[model samples]
Target: MTSTALTDDMALRIGLAARALPDTSPARLLAVLADCIGLPPNAEKLDTLSIKQLRSGASGELADCDHSVLKTALAYLNGTASTESMPPPVPQSPLINASGSDPEGTIRVAIASNNGDLLDGHFGSCERFLVYQVSADQFRLIDCREIDDRQAEDDKNSYRAGLIADCQLLYVVSIGGPAAAKVVKRDIHPIKIPDGGAAPALIGELQQIIGAKTPPWLAKIMGQPAESRVRFKARALEE
Candidate 1:
């Protein structure tokens, strides 16, 4: 097949793979793309697909496709295409479990990205924020906040932080110390995931963390609800 045809066909196959998924939101699809093609986990720069059309598109498994071309395409779109030959893509995760048990506790997160899916946007110029409600059992996308066109550049970062003020954590590829401090001042933790991965992976991993043996940081941010705590106490008394 011609290169163009191959790419289009491959893209179609990938889309089909995506559609096979139970949930095909752009954020979810991009996370799957990152798993399948070695795309870094946040909304950076992928021209082949945009986050705006994520839910409509599909992604599950691009099994038995050309790895070389896939690598080149991902690198090119991500601006990492080099003269040297691309390496083989790392193995991708097949799916993200979107369903959750009961959100033992909820941790709202903001991921910075040029697109809604990749964690590629820097603190200075991200196009939007994809907000998610995360729990050990399941997670769901709750909102997408775009940068205001009328907001001055100087105040935009702070404004963006405000947009996700209810969120507990902010994940970005990079952020300045001052901006991070500003986020912390608002009681939101800013985590710099330089090697951004898919949001589902990140969120799922955190869900596991909270569900299993939680770290101190996670525990602090995820205090049990009063009812749950009360129930636990009642159960302890019964025992």
Candidate 2:
């Protein structure tokens, strides 16, 4: 089948499916398609392709692929994946720490997310911000901020930054330079996780850092003692 036979929409779907699969290239995915359901994969072929067939055909390309990832890829290929079904439900009510108290050692963080508590959204395009109150030992989902149509107007970067201005750290799959600048201007550190994963898992990693040698920047955010901050900073500089 000629490349031209695949429409732009079909090509886009293939690209997205390829991205879903670990270490898969579009060319390799196309090869798998050819193996699974003959040449020139079209909407009909993709829509009709079975998961068993896909898994069988991907033996070489996705030998170590996670089952959920493979399923997501196939869903994308069949055009059955909907962004609406991806995200996890938010808390029924806001659970902010309203007693005017800190949890000994805690800082607020915002995670850019589109799917079910996954840190999988770019700063500019994520559907919502999952705000959490976290300490070295525990965390709680305090708020869920949605990016509505109203916020789409005028300096979107500034607006998005302002939405989570109270957060000390922001986690995202990606962020543009200008957006990062805006976040930093608001005294929020923007952290980019190129391959996003579960927010809780990422937060666990942060907790490890906090429990261990907390970085100077993090220490400052947690309002640690000046001596502790200086010690960490000196060690970091020495390293």
Residue 135 CA error for candidate 1 (Å)? 0.7
TM-score of 1: 0.51
Clashing pairs for model 2 are 87-116, 88-116
Which portions of model 2 miss their true places by more than 4 Å?
Answer: 1-84, 92-99, 234-239
Compose the digit string of candidate 1's lDDT tens values, residues 1-239: 32312254345444433322222333555555555334443323354543322322334232222232234234533444332222222222222345743244667888875543656455655667777777777777776677663574667557777888878889977676677887888888888776676776787777877664555566576775555555655665676
**In candidate 1, where is summed lDDT lowest over 10 consecutive residues?**
85-94
Candidate whose TM-score is highest: 2
Q: What local lDDT does model 1 show for residue 164?
A: 80
Q: Per-residue CA lDDT of candidate 2, range 1-239, in tens?
A: 35546778778888877755544678999988988987788878888887677777846565544455567678888888752447565654334456866566888889987678888666766678999888888877888888863655778788899999988999987676778999999999999877678998899889888875898888988889889999888887888
How far off is model 2, as Cα RMSD? 8.8
